[model samples]
Target: MWVRDDVCGLGPYQADLVETYWRWEQDPASLIGYGRQQPESLEARTEGIAHQLRGDNIRFTVYHLTDGTPEPVGVTTLLPDPSVRTAEYVVMLAPEARGMGLGTAATRLTLDYAFHITNLRMVWLKVLAPNKPAVRAYERAGFRTAGTLRQAGYWLGQVCDELLMDTLSSDFSPPSVISPLMP
Candidate 1:
C-alpha cells in the first residue's frame, strides 16, 4: 500500500471492490463528474476494470485514513505517455466522499507516486469548466491551468469547455498539513 498522510493506495481492482466500482459507473449522479450520462452495463464495467488492470496505467483505490479503518473514497490513475515521460492524471470520488479533504489528499498522493516512483516529469488532467470544486482541489494540489479546450465535452446537457491543468515535477510541493480548526 502506498501511504500518504491521510490516504492509502489499495488495489488495481480487488474482487470485493468490483461491485462498488460497477455501482458507481452505473449511477447517473456519479457519472456527472465523469462527463458521461450513459450508464455502463455490469459486464462492461467488469471488462473495463480488467482492461485497466492489464494496461500500463498506474491505478489506485484511495482510502481515507482519518478513521481507524481505511474507508474507500475513490480512485486515482496515472496513464503514462512513455515517449514524453508524462502522464494524464484522473481522479473520481464516491458521492458520499465529497466535501471532505480526501480528494486533495488523494490527488497529492497520486501525484507524488507519479513523479517520484514513475520518474514522470509532468502530470496533467482535464476538468469540465463548471466543476469549480474539482478545479480548486486540483489547484490546491499544485496543478495550474495550462489551457482550455472549447466545447470539447458534453456535460450537464450542454457542450462545455474542458480546462487542461498540469504540474511539472519541479513545481510540485507536498501539500501542507491541514489544521483541525480550518475547514
Candidate 2:
C-alpha cells in the first residue's frame, strides 16, 4: 500500500483490482468529463490497465476505511506526459462514495504521490464545467484554473465548456499532517 491514513489510503494497482475499476467507470457520474457516456467493456478497460502496468502511468486503488482493512472505494491515476514532466490526474469514485469527501481526500493523496514520490513538476486535469462538485474537489486539493476551452466537452448530446486546472509541485499541501520528503 502507498499511504494508509485516516481519510483514505492508496495501494499499487494489481490485476485483481481490474474489475473494481471497470465497475467504477460504469457509473454515469464517473463519465461526466470522459467524453463517452457509456463505459468500455471489461476487456477494453483491462487492456488500458495492462498498459498502465507497462507504461509510466502511476495508478492506485483508493481505500475507504484503512485502519482494520482498507476497503476499496475508487481509482486515481497520474498519466505522465514525460516530455513535459507533467501528468494528467484522474479520479473516479463508486456511486456510494459520491457526495462525501473521499474524492478530495483521494486527490490529495494522489497529489502527494505525484509531487513527492514521482518528482513531477505539475499535475493537471480537465473537467466539464457542469461538474461543479468535482471542480470544487479539485480546487480544494489545490488545483487552480489555467484556462477554459469553450464548448470543448460533449455530454448527453450537449456541448459544454471545459476547465483546465492544474497544481504544481510548489502547490503542495500534503495529504497528511506531516509533509512529504524534500531536500
- TM-scores of the candidates are 0.89, 0.89
How well does candidate 1 score on lDDT at residue 28?
Answer: 72
Name the runs in model 2 displaced over 4 angstroms: 174-183
Candidate with maximal TM-score: 2
lDDT of 2: 0.84
lDDT of 1 by residue, 45-150 (tens): 7777777777888888888677788877788889899999999998888888877877787888777777766889999999999888899999988899999999
For model 1, the stretches where C-alpha displacement exceeds 4 angstroms are 7-12, 175-183
Tens-digit lDDT track of model 2 for 98-174: 78899888999888878767789999999998888889999998999999999998867888999999999988854
Supply every candidate's count of residue pairs whose N, Cα or C atoms clash at under 3 angstroms: 0, 0
After TM-score superposition, what is the CA distance of residue 70 in candidate 1 from its true location, in Å? 0.6
Task: Please tell me which predicted candidate would have the highest lDDT against the true structure.
Answer: 2
Model 2 scores worst on lDDT over the 10 consecutive residues at 174-183
